[model samples]
Target: MATPLTAPTTDPGCRVLGLRERKKQRTRDALVDAAHRLFLTQGYGRTTVDEIAASVDVSQRTFFRYFANKEEVALAVMSDAEDYFIDCLRRRPADENPLQAMRAAITEAWLELGQDDQSGPAGVTAALELFELLETTPTLLAAHLRRTTEQEGVVAGVLAEREGLDAAVDLRPRLLAAVFGAVVRLSHLSWTSDTAAHAAGPDGMIALIERHFDQLGPALAGSWR
Candidate 1:
């Protein structure tokens, strides 16, 4: 089943105070942060939305404004990485094969992710912190899997758009996207195992992803075709 996305709420209740989409994003961020910390403390399934709502200093309704359920939000909250991932996909050179382009782009992009918040994106430590929190908790595991699966549809769409009504265009792009997400997630889990080692930023990650491409590059062949 397609996971339901909650419509952005428009209500400006005392606690909410604005248009649904803006309110939704803020509330989502707040609730996710709260749940993240709480999961680290109380365990994932044990941390109730009510508790998350309480910690974020918002009421139940305010929490609902952003997430349909604690599971969906908690599971999906850390997914801000997709934007960077998409950017990497876009960075492929015009002359490069789609797969090779994606590989190079991802390698370079991951290096960018290693930069400190001062460099503007979530730094090495932050990425590991989020990954660590997710790794240790089985409750959030299913949610993580679900979120990863959801990313395939997104990748598929990106791939489909690149092809201009070509009858022979294969489903390779969607398959490639799935494989790419899996590889990236695997690489992330590996690097984050001792994030401090990669704290200097992209150099280590570029090396790691380059190695991943050595093994997995074929999966992305003709993906953007």
Candidate 2:
């Protein structure tokens, strides 16, 4: 079980994993909140994990238990969207074309139909700040790449089922799934990086994805060998 962020210390043989999990979560949350504040006030390169721990009143060792280091904290926080995407991908239809199923699922999961059309207002600004931070940090960039790899595997597994492919289909769907998922991700990146003109807000994400499917449709269809 994952450790909770709030645990001061745990017995080597403690029985309640749930409490420990919650404690670890609390500690991780504290560290992230501290680090985020420090990042904005002092800048990303200027911040340190020790300083984040100090600000949160946790020992640096406790901080390490939740995240290997400061970069990992940013990685963990920035990964929430990808994590959500994985869950939605799993819930998509087993029979529908993988890309088409993705269209409805992604829109319903992340885009609110009314209002600002971004994420919820309560969390929008924080998410945007995190997006901006990822733009410049190489460590976070690498972590994001690894996150994308995991998402690609998810897409491939769903595609295999949707296409009713057997073991003989080997490498085909894997590449297509990765390509499609990457384009979908890039569409959101464009939206996040430049939102000033997004009158449709995040709806631009789905529209951009549709354009990819349209442009690539002939290519995708022809390759179903």
What C-alpha lDDT does candidate 1 achieve relative to the native structure? 0.60
Model 2 C-alpha lDDT per residue in residues 1-225, reported as the tens digit of each score = 122211224322334457666576566666766777777667788998889899878888888887887777765544655555555666777766666777766665455322222232213344445655677787777777787787777767766766777524677667876777667656656767555524454455557666666767776566655
Task: Give stretches of model 1 more than 4 Å off.
Answer: 1-24, 87-93, 104-124, 163-169, 194-207, 217-225
Per-residue lDDT for 41-100 in model 1, tens only? 676668788998998789989888777887666655346555556666665556665567
Q: Please provide TM-scores, in order, for all candidate models, with all chains considered together.
A: 0.67, 0.69
lDDT score of residue 195 within candidate 2: 57
Residue 68, candidate 1: how far off, in angstroms? 1.7
TM-score of model 2 (CA atoms)? 0.69
